[model samples]
Target: MGVSKLDILYRRLLLTKLFIRGWGRPEDLKRLFEFRKMIGNRERCQNLVSSDYPVHIDKIEEQSDCKILDGHFVSPMAHYVPDIMPIESVIARFQFIVPKEWNSK
Candidate 1:
């Protein structure tokens, strides 16, 4: 193979960093940690609630004269600079994507 998996992972991480910055700053790191506890294993990745945002974004794109920028952070701190969104919204929608073993006996 010409490409290394490590290289690919790095490239993907680079893209992720760009996207995260594109959203601006993390509103509440404390809230984020609470989310981490719910999700388990702390991973500081970009949070985008597909269920809400994708649909909301599509409708906005179709409707308004204003240019829709993906989605906005609903958190009070993030209201001004809502780029990264927040994990709170996703957990609110999908519940937790807990492992099968964790759920079943």
Candidate 2:
């Protein structure tokens, strides 16, 4: 994840952090909340829609880009940070294991 700070994706990631923690300008927050709710609902229904469609599943391990990061956060601070420091910003990244293929250029 060697993304530069000036990159647009990096900015979007910062915006995502703000949106998730319910902090931002009113108009931006409104739009973010709207889209967040829409996407959240769509993700929530994915399992139901998949069951209905009953599409064939692929053996993803055979794919050329199939790399899974198997890991979990030990101490996620985002949940409790807001309560202590209302104005402070928080960005967290955890170490995870990814296939060598993915790490290779």
Candidate 3:
């Protein structure tokens, strides 16, 4: 399914809140989880939180000037915002499943 404009707006709003509040509130953390789930990145979000929650929060704080545009992350330092890849394309690029038969070879 294609990302809706509402989703993009939601993400932008959520990130804005995070940038302002610094993720200290439980409500904000819950919202962050919801945002990650919406973007199909819950696992990565969890990993970042578990590995170094403070650092993760710091990174968001550092990107205070960044913006989310139609699901693409845009940084002030970047001259161009790259196109957002479809979910299928992203999954195909990162997912590697070895055939079961390969184990017996």
lDDT (Cα, tens digit) per residue for candidate 3, span 55-90:
111121122444322222222112111223333443
For candidate 1, lDDT tens digit of each residue in 1-105?
Answer: 255798668546545656457733334434554454544533422342334543222222332333333433344324323433656653222212223244456
lDDT of 1 at 60: 27
For all candidates in order, the CA lDDT equals 0.41, 0.43, 0.41
lDDT, candidate 2, 37-104, per-residue tens: 54467655354333343223322233355443332331222342232323333432233434546455
Best prediction by lDDT = 2
User: What 10-residue stretch in candidate 1 is worst by lDDT?
Assistant: 91-100
Clashing pairs for predicted structure model 2, backbone only: none
Task: Give the clash count for each candidate.
Answer: 1, 0, 0
| Full-model lDDT, candidate 1 | 0.41
Q: Tell me the spans in candidate 2 whose CA falls farther than 4 Å from its real position.
A: 1-23, 43-92, 97-105
C-alpha displacement of 79 in model 1, angstroms?
A: 15
